[model samples]
Target: MSEVREYIAHARSVVIKIGSSALTDLADGLDKARLDRLADAIEARMRAGSDVIVVSSGAIGAGIAPLGLKKRPTDLATKQAAASVGQLALAHAWGTSFARYDRTVGQVLLTADDISNRAHHANAQRTLDRLRSLGAVAVVNENDTVATNEIRFGDNDRLAALVAHLAGADALVLLSDVDGLYDGDPRKVSETGERARFIPEVSGPEDLDGVIAGSGGALGTGGMASKLAAARLSADAGVPVLLASAEQAGQALADASVGTVFAARPERLSARKFWVRHAADARGQIVLDDGAVAAVSRRRRSLLAAGVVGVEGRFSDGDVVELVDTTGRIHARGVVAFDSDDISSMMGAHSEELPADLARPVIHADDLVPL
Candidate 1:
């Protein structure tokens, strides 16, 4: 507990993710009072000399009442329409709330492409850095208005985790409906007649075994499973995470003992490696022979064409692909150096035996991230 408090005290920057269940309702839309309270809490953190970024989820839910929809739309197109309308209202509400304290808020909407593509990812990092430097709280959300199913983040919880890495945050606070993680579903009593127990900390993946993740609320897409996934993602990147109820936003931000804290891993992956391992969408798969698997996964060597067994899916040079063993287990993710067709033709041939243009590594070690 002392260590957790120390970690929170030393965190210079943090990302706060507020879910839809905490921000809106199916019929009432955005809750002005709740937004104000949250804004006030964020402002307090800023006044305390810590940089803060908010990854908010409520665009579609906030649009429900305005669009006369009785519930969340199941179709992609209608959901996108609602997001477009609600995005404006959501941003305005945030802007208006922060205005009370004379704090400026900047809205940043992102699609999956924005975070996965190298160039776009760099651009986003620059924008976020500049916003922080200028003392503005960046309000980020998934760009559901224009995102297709293929490029959507699916939920803001995942987006927040990715953003924590992108923004180089020291901590991430996930504000949801539940107070914290529990050993069992908090809504039900166990056969032993005992209620679920609140977990103060999660040290590793093993802590989650046997834990039941309850379903999400009517207005939110993410349940406990998504929150845990997000926490692990950020924790792996060396950012600690706190999961708490929205009602306790102030305590959570203050690093009080009010939520579950996920410990950060000691070894942090490089930004590029982390991106490849978690963010880049695999466009294809390169199946390797046994020898190739050992070399790439164990020795961390560049993938050579001599041990290539097969190629699955069509992908261009420089696209992200999965490096898998012949048995279909993925060993790594890498940026391939050749087109799928070219790789197909070069497989099983040594580099020295190939033409000068095709003699290089199929995937450079620097571009590979072992899973």
Candidate 2:
């Protein structure tokens, strides 16, 4: 067995993500008892000197009762309306709970733009870092009030994973209603009437093939599949993750192997790469031929106009764009060097024949990330 306690013993920074189902009572909403339990555990871990950042989800669930809604709203406008009201209640519960232990909690709400835009991404990172520096527990949540369905992070799990990378956390704990991933749906009784087999650890993608994840809860958007996706994403960024029940928050935060654990990658990705891989939103795509695809993926070469056969979307220079092959497979994502108009005219042209300024590669190797 892996020594879970030992790993937590050495971790300098940790991220604890509490799901909406964990924090709210479906009927009553904003369950203080559960929130208190979570806060107490997190405060203990934070007091021990590890920088702790929390990605919490509960606003919409908490809003249900106060708004007199029968269930979670399905429409974007109603959902946003609930978020605007419930966020305050959710923050209060967290703040008051932490206050009991003399720890301050800061609420930082983020929209997709906060993580997808280059400048906003950095600013968000700096804000969280500063919050940790001041010995305050930073409580983060999606800005559901203003986010559109097209751009919103559908689940907090993905947001938590991205935040773990942005905050440079060593470990991530996803506290949910379910304890861990299982070979079969735990809720479904087997022919022998036995619970599904538990999956203690997942080394990589192949281990997840047989695992079937269920849908999201009535109170939240994330389910087992989303948590697994989040875990893998964080792992790729070199942050190990624990998927455990909220009841096991204390054990999970202490690094005990209470739930499924996904191992981190051998090497950590650079901050820029992590952003490019997880957070950057591509504004357009540049379709490349077979040769161009091989050049970028195998040879690690910059994308030049000569290799470009077509472009999609209208974007200015410095915007993030995708490099795709004739098959429409995205080979890489990078910041375009030329405006869409300039690139359109430059396509299929030799490098030397182009104007001196336009001679530069359309997407430099340093700016490109092979998917």
Query: Considering every candidate listed, which one attains the maximal TM-score?
Result: 1
For residues 130-225, what per-residue lDDT tens digits would candidate 1 score against the true structure?
Answer: 999998889999998999888988788899999999999988889989999998788899899999988888888888887887666788889998
CA lDDT, every model vs. true structure: 0.91, 0.88
Candidate 1: where is the Cα deviation over 4 Å? Answer: none
Q: Estimate each model's TM-score.
A: 0.96, 0.95
- How does model 1 score by TM-score? 0.96
Clash number by candidate, in order: 0, 0
- Compared with the true structure, model 2 gives a TM-score of 0.95
Output the lDDT of residue 216, model 1. 69
The weakest ten consecutive residues by lDDT in model 2 span 1-10
Model 2 RMSD to the real structure? 1.7
lDDT of 2: 0.88
